[model samples]
Target: MSGKQDCKTRYPLLLAHGLGVTEHGGLYVPWGRVPDVLRAHGAEVCFGGQDAWGSIETGAAQLAEAVRKIRHLYGCERVNIIAHSKGGLEARHLISAMGYGKYVASLTMLSTPNRGSRVAELLLHARPGVAVWARGNDAWWRQGGDKHPDALRAGEQLTPAYLEIFNRTHPDACCVYYQSWGARLGKHNTDAAMRLTHGLFYPAHGDSDGLVTPQSARWGRYRGTLTGVSHQQLVDAQGVDSGGFDVRGFYVRLVQELVQMGF
Candidate 1:
């Protein structure tokens, strides 16, 4: 049930990154480490232009545009999406709101905040300093609309309003299967920076992935939880030197699954 075969050969993968990150097509985590593995197995990767820290809608639009460009470049009609964190939300919106499902094959989300993050909520109210910092970033302003109030409002609730819209439009798009995975920090040693950030932004969901809770990361349907993997660890924990669980095997397994599923 995949889309046109030509598209698969031209743009085999569309890798979308989470917020506060660059979209210059560099490898990040799991993608950084595993993408090559997939390529070795005959996969072509592309970038889904991501916002530095934009709203879900804005990011989704950028992703859709990227997909369109990929399609045009490759002369294919469909592509697969591999998104991380908030990137997952953007990918979902592309399929639903932007009518990209017709051109998509599969969507694989890793450690995404699908149900909204208590951390983001807390930051909306507690951290005036961070908000000011976020304002200076072009990506943030693009996604948040150049106003703290708007950003706060948009992130206030993972409201039924947003969820209902996405569910209605994307509830199983043709030939596009939605899948997700989440991880936890377990201990402060996983990432001292993340530990400090989590303490400040989301003290409630202790042992979370700095920005999102394990529960919020579970989107669409239950796949399986990767125990002991941190938010960043889910990508590539090779020899780069980082704390938390060893996710090398996890990345291998996930890429293997995507290949087996014909992503």
Candidate 2:
């Protein structure tokens, strides 16, 4: 039964990546082997295909299109979304603000800054050169295939103040089921790649996955945090298990639960 097709859902699953990433390129997958594993378990997996640095609104627009395309291609009425980090915000915007609520069966978010990120606020409010830095990011991403990337605006939208307004404006749709998961680094040295971010995020927020805190990551159902995992590790960016946390298996179980839920 372990090798059986057990993770299939009523609606297809769409994997939405976080900020500063493409879904997959070459042998690299921001979601690691999760997509393939889900497919192997009888799940029809798809990608949100949003821009790496686009604002939530723009990302939502892209997701809206992706949902429509997926619905048409798969001949399904709705999809179950598994969004990471900022992608969660985009998914929320699509379902609530973009009038795609009826098209989404459920939303499962990972390490999303639902309330907002103090780290983002700290970075954005750093200096007068923030605008220049944002422009530089946009330029780089544009060169990398993002048509109208707005790094500054996108970063602003991640701040607590902006998210406060955002949460008020984009309330959860009654038609959609929403759930979220967070991650944590355990200690400052849990993941060397996340060391700096963990250092920066830990003082202000108690438990975090380098970038997003547990509090900020909680929204809707609030499934709790994945202990001993970094923001990157949560998405399997490094593609290896860490401290007993099997990122791939975690996603498999997640989808399996979705299956049980009749999504």
Local distance difference test, each candidate:
0.64, 0.86
* Cα lDDT tens digits for candidate 1, 62-164: 8888888888888887887878887888788888777788898888888887766766655555557755654555454555442222344345434334555
- Tell me the deviation in Å of residue 62 in model 2: 0.5
- Runs in model 2 lying further than 4 Å from the true structure: 1-3, 25-29, 188-190
Q: Which candidate should be chosen as best, given TM-score against the real structure?
A: 2
Task: List clash counts for every candidate, in order.
Answer: 5, 0
RMSD of candidates 1 onward, in order: 5.7, 2.1
Could you tell me the lDDT of residue 55 within candidate 2? 92
TM-score of every candidate: 0.76, 0.95
Error of 2 at 249 (Å): 1.0
- Weakest 10 consecutive residues, lDDT, candidate 1? 1-10
Off by over 4 Å in 1: 1-11, 24-31, 127-131, 139-170, 201-203, 237-249
